[model samples]
Target: MGFCSYKSFVILFCLIFTPLTKADLLSATLNYHQGSYSEAKREFLQLAHLGNADAIYNVAVMYLHGQGVEKNKAQAFAWFSLAADFGLLDARDTAMLIAEQTDNKQPLDDAYNALLKQLSFQWYDQQLRPELNASPALHLSPERRYTVEPKYPEHAYKNGIEGWVWLEFDIDKSGAVTDITLIDSYPEKTFDKAIINAVRRWQYQGNNQTLPYYNRSLLYHFTTYKGKQYEQSFKSQQREYNEKISDLIDAAEQGNALVQYYIANWLSSNDYNATRLLKYHWQQANANGELLLRSAVNGYANSQYRIGANMLRGKYGKVDREKGLNWILLAAQSGFASAQYRLGRELLNSQYVDYAPNKALKWLRAAAEQGLFSAKRDIALLLFDLKKPMQQVSTALNEALAGDNEHPQLLLLKAKIHAATGNSNDARKLSNSALKEAQTRNWDQSSIRHFIATLP
Candidate 1:
């Protein structure tokens, strides 16, 4: 190996073995900034594992470039998301490249939620509470805090409307409303529009003088009981989405064939959070099997693929890799493209079950033959790992993203491959393309930025 390669390995080894001190981390970062990738990677890895989100994102960059470690998209994504979760803004920005590889929302949401959770605003309801006065005299004063009350049209909600509309808004210092985000609403756009318009015009008094002010989440539960009773309550609907998602998740947990099959796929997709979109609506169709078991037995290929994946990952329940392999194999054999790709992956990952690279390759080839982009990508990675025929693997990446246009994963892979071939300009172009795609989709730009930083 070359001196740079040997030094890179040493740096990576030190990063994994040695605990990173704050000063050491700073030194490592400076080394990285000064073009010492191996040293920076080692220091960043240590810091990343120590819960430093920035370090995690930096480590992801190292992985993306194969600077001091082997380039691995999966590892990079995992680290990027971990850093993003730690409130590292850059990590959140980089997650988009990985998001384009698959329709999975796990990485995207995982990254966004990581930063969001660390914020005081995330637990605003819990952290920022109304300060009640010590005496009864306080009760005599007018209501200070903004109180959200929904004005439901008496006849409208009673006539047909059901479900809840959740609104997230910022309360300005002057007690005025701004930046109103409609979080969750009935699938009906008309209903959502009505609620948003009405809430925008409404204002509330600030809560006492001490409370400068913060954002508030208001849930308008437009329920119709009996024939004409419409009650609109000012409760947070955050729990409703939680509850509904929870119920579907429970059904998924229970091994209901339909729920099992689709839940993982839903969790994987961008709109998996039950956003008001057609994709989620399709998920609802699969989830409907909760009511009828007989119907659930026969769902779509996507649902079956998801269930098989969850079972393989042991996410729904126990770690029954054998059963998971069987289900995935079954789905694959049934001509489900996604299932075929997953089965190939399961075979590739199966170490305890058996070590069969040839068998894994066979399945991967089968999936790739059918134009499964993920399978093709995985195949490229596997080929690269084996140190055999990498040029073909690079070419396959473009084919993987053939019709989908500029997919982030494919673009990143292209960037990596181009950089490996000494085409710095091409690598930079691909990296920039990936960055633009990620930004347009609002996935995460940090990872992409990190990639750009490494370019010659």
Candidate 2:
């Protein structure tokens, strides 16, 4: 049979064996089994773009065995690493195995890191699904059999850069750490690799009686010992700031709103006061809040917004909804885009306030006019909810999508617009594409699927 005919036959067989949504995957698998390596590779690549973990792993295998592509272990490693990140255990094991076998693993590591960075844009494209409360938290803490301290990166040390990295990993049944993820970091990415490398070599005590622990969190702080000479330099800098601070305090006392705001910020900063300054000259309990209040009283819009936001969240003390809203309104009235957006969101969501959709739309529009993509997205959503004209909704969505086309929620909204406009095929295709993107991020797709099902 001709190649196209054979491909059709394989697809037909796949339809019999799998759901229509997964026919493409089964078809690709059949093609691979039939020794049509090139065809299988092509199909897998297409599916992989939609974030299919199985297709991603199959692509890595084909690259590893030189079935359809040239034998490139580095490429295979990159693909396997990506597949592992997509939650494939086999891919994770294969990636680690390849790393162990490779002489001079730097190139493979580089390939993997590079691929991750290249694909990092998709990380923020979808909102994560809320996990069900299925499993209880681990009661017993695992004992460490071996621990390795991460070495400070020479470049970072020389530059006097200090930061901390937070990581989350799982301890497998064999007591080896696996699926290590960098949760967050200060001076981001600088200490990420150092922490990840160290954690991978750590060994934990395995027990037959207990299940392996998952989502173990660890934070590593990288501090530099700046030596006596550096300490002297730091003291000198502190002396200089001390000399200048008295004049600033005088200005702040004289009702210089900007100076008051500046002093408030410096006083509030833990980093500035603890590590870099002689706090004796300026320290006062709740002084930052006092100064911020003074500045806001003197009509500093930024100070008003900061105090309002802090009050709303109870960052300094107790939450005061009425006072916080008043302060935020003052800032928004002064045309602060961020304050405008915040007020709009709070109004729309009835967060510490009554729902006022019209008022929310007004502030959102003001913020959107100042070029905030998030504000534009909110404006589109508000307009849609208000059952405004389709043209206005489309215009707002188009503007927002221009800023971030990969946003799954916006894409799904666009699909809804298409469905409303009597474009069922386009609606289905766009919805499916959005669903695939959301799946790649492991987001909940039940609502999206329901919407798709309702469409013609």
Candidate 3:
């Protein structure tokens, strides 16, 4: 906290006050920076409830050093352990020291035991993602009870900046939108704030109880046509596009990757009818798709990803599995975080790509290193499974927990690790906790239960 440069403080202030970021995170950081320790602590507590790792770590730090709060080592230890379980490196180190100190007083490894207990406790996702994808058995993404519509940006409307932005977010167990990432935006930053603000006000019924979070994404399209505007709307119609289609050809020709993608998008927008699960690829040679192909050839990572993804879906043309994977790999190799994550995830989970644990770990590690929270969590599970070094396991696990503390895969791996280390009590505790959480998340728990039975 004290080591930040003036530039860092200025950047922090920008992140805190930036309209595009969440208000709670903004307020909390502002409090921290303004020497309002107690106020910051309270705001950070609010973020912790949403399962934000940074907030959890801040709260732990406050308790550890008594900044704006009374010093309580046990409280600090618990909070730190929780944060560590979610992959907070600082928290992991501090929690270890606190654990050691606590145990020395007890003449045993009780501090470590306490730390282990904290680790075993359920770490909520707080809406970064759903540990459980919606399936027949896993009833997630409950019906929307209330949704606050996002306002169309006046500036955008006036300027005829009409296109869509891709957004991904999670509806928490309590049916609140927690984590949101702008996957892509057309016309760059025009309507990002508008779309994000609107999505945040949405509320869900959440399975009539506290079900696990649900991961969802949608296209927030801003459209202006015939000199008329609509106050931002969600649409699945990829073919029904904006009026700016004619202007993108020049931008695409200018070698702008973003513009190239948008140009390709505009050109191909009306060609495919994926909405009906039908396609017409043999009908004509369209410049829209050709423009995209050219952009892909130009080594634009975003275009590569888009083209790869589009081909995989057989949207713009026939399904080109080989070409699709090649583009995806190109994008991934170029260090696109999303592409790296997608490639890594496929390799990790045996998706369309073959399962290559080592490769998956490497690619995922790359993405995680770039600050992709989901990738960090995924790598922790992958690393643990690979039986890599213990330090690595601990580090990856701690990092992964920051976003998804109760991830089922991580829990199972931790349980196995505890059992291998001969901490039978800890193993049993974590195993039981894992099963309960998995069941609550409506995950397939047969494997987990089997593992538990084999443990002494």
Candidate 4:
């Protein structure tokens, strides 16, 4: 009863005509729902090139939500306008709505203006994610018990060599790294030994249930500023400025408090064109501090946390131990999720003040309740760290895994907790699940199985 089954009817007599692009639209929608936004965006763009209204509208939605690409309302509005020109009623409605919401006066307006010509805009949300530190850490890595920073190789550091290393490794039952195979190393062995060696020296408390296999993708930059080691990505100012970085600088220069917060972090990076007469690493660290202080003074909670973390991590020369704690306290008191986790972790690790494990657990619980993805796993780690009752560790492990059943690190952590609690059967079951996930995800784990077999 149909050319391409029941789906054919929905395209016909619809606001937009889909001659051959019907399948593409459906595929793009499926990809979007499946969290394959980048692929979905590409599919939509192909349809948009052929003047498909639904595809154009979906592209606008992606831009509006910052799903695949960076969020840009002007770009979303412009795409919607194009769809409106093609007689899409929904796109017309959305274009009109967003047009009223934004005025094209600012500098970021240029992209929108280039698309439509003369679209004015106003400023929008300017806060950067905490840029004070290096670009966000591994989006997914196990909670650290002891992390050994990769030693800066003097040979590479002197030459300003910077590159990344993709590493695959397995932790044994005793939490010692066993097999470390270099998946790939950029610039050919420039920084592999440093990363591999440091990773080997790294320590984790491996319990009976913890998955023995683990994986990581690590980046190393051998950079120096005024003869001091700088391990961050923002090495020099002359590197190609992505649109987002450019926009941050533009807004920060214009005195945007949120942008200033980001600029402060960017300034501290050694990656920002040190070839210039005025090097940024040591010179800009103070400037970065000032900008953070500016945003912190305005009560931006993240700025408060970033400054505190930088202080604790030792930016500049001296560390004001008390001041750093106070900054963390202010952010935690303001109910920031990241700060709560940090404060909790700090308390758990503190050698001074009687090592308040209960207080640390409370702070970690607060952070986890606020939906920080890592906090739940952190709490599980903490319970094991505290060497609590087996029942308590089991309960915490269940709570952590309940929120993220397939998170590779959480699954392994659950196994570890079971092993530590002397639940061999439970430990083995969870370890098997972890191995299954790691294999399905294409993670190499040849060394791990042997270690798991050796567990108590």
Per-candidate local distance difference test: 0.51, 0.67, 0.60, 0.58
Model 2 lDDT, residue 146, Cα = 90
Cα lDDT for residue 66, candidate 2: 96
Give RMSD to native, each candidate.
Answer: 27.6, 30.2, 23.8, 18.7
Cα lDDT of model 2 by residue, 87-163, tens digit = 78888899999999999898898887887765532541231111111222334457789999999898877666666
Q: Ranking by lDDT, best first?
A: 2, 3, 4, 1
List where candidate 1 sits over 4 angstroms from the true fold.
1-307, 310-316, 350-358, 369-371, 444-456
Task: Give the Cα-based TM-score of candidate 3 against the true structure.
Answer: 0.47
- List ranges where model 2 is wrong by over 4 Å: 1-229, 236-238, 273-278, 350-353, 440-446
TM-score, candidate number 1: 0.35
Looking at model 2, residue 135 earns an lDDT score of: 29
Residues 251-285 of candidate 4 have per-residue lDDT tens digits of 44433445455445445455533222123222553
lDDT of 4: 0.58
**Per-residue C-alpha lDDT of model 1 across residues 159-216, encoded as one tens digit per residue:** 4434456565544434555445453343335357667766665555644551223224
Candidate 3 regions off by >4 Å?
1-162, 167-182, 187-220, 224-248, 266-288, 316-319, 349-355, 406-408, 428-456
The candidate that wins on TM-score is 2
Error at 134, model 1, angstroms: 49
The 10-residue segment of model 2 with minimum total lDDT is 7-16
The lowest-lDDT stretch of 10 consecutive residues in candidate 4 is 119-128
* Highest-scoring model, lDDT: 2
- Higher-lDDT candidate among 1 and 4? 4
Using TM-score as the measure, what is the rank order of every candidate, best first? Answer: 2, 3, 4, 1
Candidate 3 lDDT (Cα, 0 to 1): 0.60
